[model samples]
Target chain A: MRTILILKRLITVFYYLIFIGLIAQLFRIINQIITGKIHDLKPKIFGEQLDYGTMSLFEIGLSGVVPVVLFYCFFQSLIYLKRSLKDLESGNYFSALVITNFKKIGILFLVCSLGEVIGKLLFFIVFKSKFHFELDSSVVLFFIMGLFFMFLSEVFQKARRLQQENELTI
Target chain B: MLAKREMKSKELAEIIGITTANLSILKSGKAKAVRFSTLEAICKALDCQPSDILEYKED
Candidate 1:
């Protein structure tokens, strides 16, 4: 239960980071567009950017889709975990939601990580063809964080098994 | 000869990985079976042998 709460809180932070990262970029754009010279504020795709800033349809479309899928999968995992914890605390062990949704979350995280990697590679290809943007280390860093969660899920599963065995003996 | 080593199940359980409730079940022999790992952990925690645990009844 405590572990679930920790995970739940972390998910909130995770989503917040995602929102902040994306919105910061948009705000930068907003600041540029608002400056007195709107004519000089033509949409520009810098070669050094790793984003959906100013790009052709196919590239931007792929970038746009990844974040949507990542968010969808992440929120779905969070909701499942929340419901699972609520059910358990209300004394519904038979319907332990975490155990049920654990595997699905693992799968989604894997997919999300893959999407991130692919998006990074795509950005590297498209943008570097114009100008050089240093690859962001934060991408791999977050993916490592995802792996840490995956490892934790395994530990939770083991702990659950031990708990169940103890209960059965009683 | 049962040289007794006295300890409450709860006390033993706190020291061990298993719960007091589980220890109670084991002590009463109501437990269906004990896994070797759990058994080892219990024995180690209690500082005793299986013979210290299992009672002998001569029929």
Candidate 2:
């Protein structure tokens, strides 16, 4: 229990850090757009520097959609994670709601990771750029962590059923 | 009946092989269900018939 409490606190701190990081990213993107930096598509692509430019407005718009969707999914997973941690802190370890939230977080992480891969493929096709495709370690880690949480959710569901049975047993 | 039989709750619980807390649950009518084995143990410990102790009431 003490370990869970400490872990919950650590997760809370990490959540705040991620939230701040996301805000900084948003601000940086806004600054870049305001300074016309977005017009030059020479930015980093899949962790590799690409010198491609001369993209159509529609292509740029489509490229922007991927990152936005990725961020939305990531943030949503974080929300579910926070809720699950809160439920744990409240001593509702076997709660069905917590299990549902864990499953949601897991699915969202999977969506984000898959979305990144698909987005990279779409970017390569639409932009007609010679980009090296390398799998991101962080995205892979997220995918594995998502699977772990999904497994944990199943374990919790079983434990919840046992708890209910114990409570009802005379 | 325990007072008439000179048996404490602890004694009854010990005879029935259950904790006092669980016996209290049965006594308080908070138990969801009781097994026949446990019911028989309780009846044997108290020296009573099932009809003497068990009563059904609708929720």
Candidate 3:
């Protein structure tokens, strides 16, 4: 019980940090453009720079709309996570529920992740970046993985709902 | 896999200010989402815990 509580707190911290970090990455890129420096400023993971191709249609689509959509998705996921954890702590896991919207988001992520892999391979072939592009397929993959995690949580939520309904009818 | 359960899906709906269809959706687990306040009203009308309306399985 104590361990779960600690873990929940840790999860909250991770959520906050990742959100802030993503925002900071965007900020740095915007700032660099304002100052007119050619130095790369895109976010990095595991010491390797990622490529975000300017000519990639996938990236162009993601730029104006994908960021907002991804952020909305992540926010909705966090809400569900918050509810599930609360239910768990209350020993109400049997009553918790997950909506179908979450599942759709999960599948969306899965598709996007695959798309990103294709994007990465294509970019490499085209020599889109000498160092790395502004948008990395890796981050897109991470977003998709996050959706996968949410999908799993939704499964648990459905299980809980089923349990609660059974108890009522019997 | 076992016997199906019954829900006052309509009676509860009328009291809770939801349409019969919405209540049915929730009762049938076809609902995309549920409001907390609606859940609370359903619990009250049905005179049961939320668990009474939801169940768990091991698979």
Candidate 4:
């Protein structure tokens, strides 16, 4: 219980830090764009940096959108994580809300990671570019973590059913 | 069973040392299981056997 409290505090700190860092980075990029020094920035999408000069406006917009979407997914997962941790601290392991949140977190992770892969595939197909199948370790980790959360939600669901049955047995 | 035994649900619930809500749950067939002690209490209060109250049906 003490450990969970400590962990929750740590997560809260990290959550704020990440949020601030992302926002700061966004402002810095905007500042640079306004200053007309965009060439100095090497922005990456799905871990690969693209040549902005050669790419069309649509491609640049798509690249920019993907990172923002991924960040949103990450933030959402963190929010759910914080909520689940709070529930755990309150000894609410089998709550429906926590279970649903876990499921949502898993889905968000899976969709974000898998969507990156699918987006890469589609980009390569549309552009008739050389298909280089490079699997980032982080993406694989996200996928596995997503599956684990999904499994956790299922286990919680079963435990909740047993608890209800036990409670009603009287 | 309470109707046949001329006992109110509240009266039976008090006699069994359980809440009326639980009694309602049992009456409404919403309870997942019944304990032996609870079954014994219900049978003793209603003056009936377990078999009289419990019935199996094919779903």
Highest lDDT scorer: 4
Tens digits of per-residue lDDT, candidate 2, A1-170, equal: 89878988887898899889989878986887798786665666555455436666676676668878988898888778777887898898999889999888888888888888888877776666656465889879888988988998899999998888778677
Ranking under lDDT, best-scoring first? 4, 2, 1, 3
* lDDT (10s digit) by residue, model 4, range B1-59: 77798889999999998999999999888899898999999999989999999898776
Clashing pairs in 4: none
Computed on C-alphas against the true complex, the DockQ of each candidate is: 0.19, 0.52, 0.04, 0.67
Error of 3 at A101 (Å): 7.0
**Candidate 2 local lDDT, residue A12:** 82
- lDDT of the candidates, in the order given: 0.61, 0.82, 0.59, 0.85
Deviation (Å) of A36 in candidate 3: 2.2
The TM-score between candidate 1 and the true structure equals: 0.45
Which runs in model 2 stand beyond 4 Å of their true positions? A31-42, A50-53, A130-133, B1-41, B44-46, B49-59
DockQ-based ranking, best first? 4, 2, 1, 3
Give per-residue lDDT, candidate 3, residue B47: 72
TM-score against truth, every candidate: 0.45, 0.71, 0.44, 0.78
Q: Where is model 1 more than 4 Å wrong at Cα?
A: A1-60, A87-96, A127-137, B1-31, B34-59
**Model number with the top TM-score:** 4
Per-residue alpha-carbon lDDT of candidate 2 for residues B8-49, written as tens digits (9 for 90 to 100): 999999999999999898888988788898899988988999
- lDDT string, candidate 3, A55-170, tens digits: 25455334335344545655665655655666667776544243443454565565455544444455444443443334566667767575776776677677866775654431
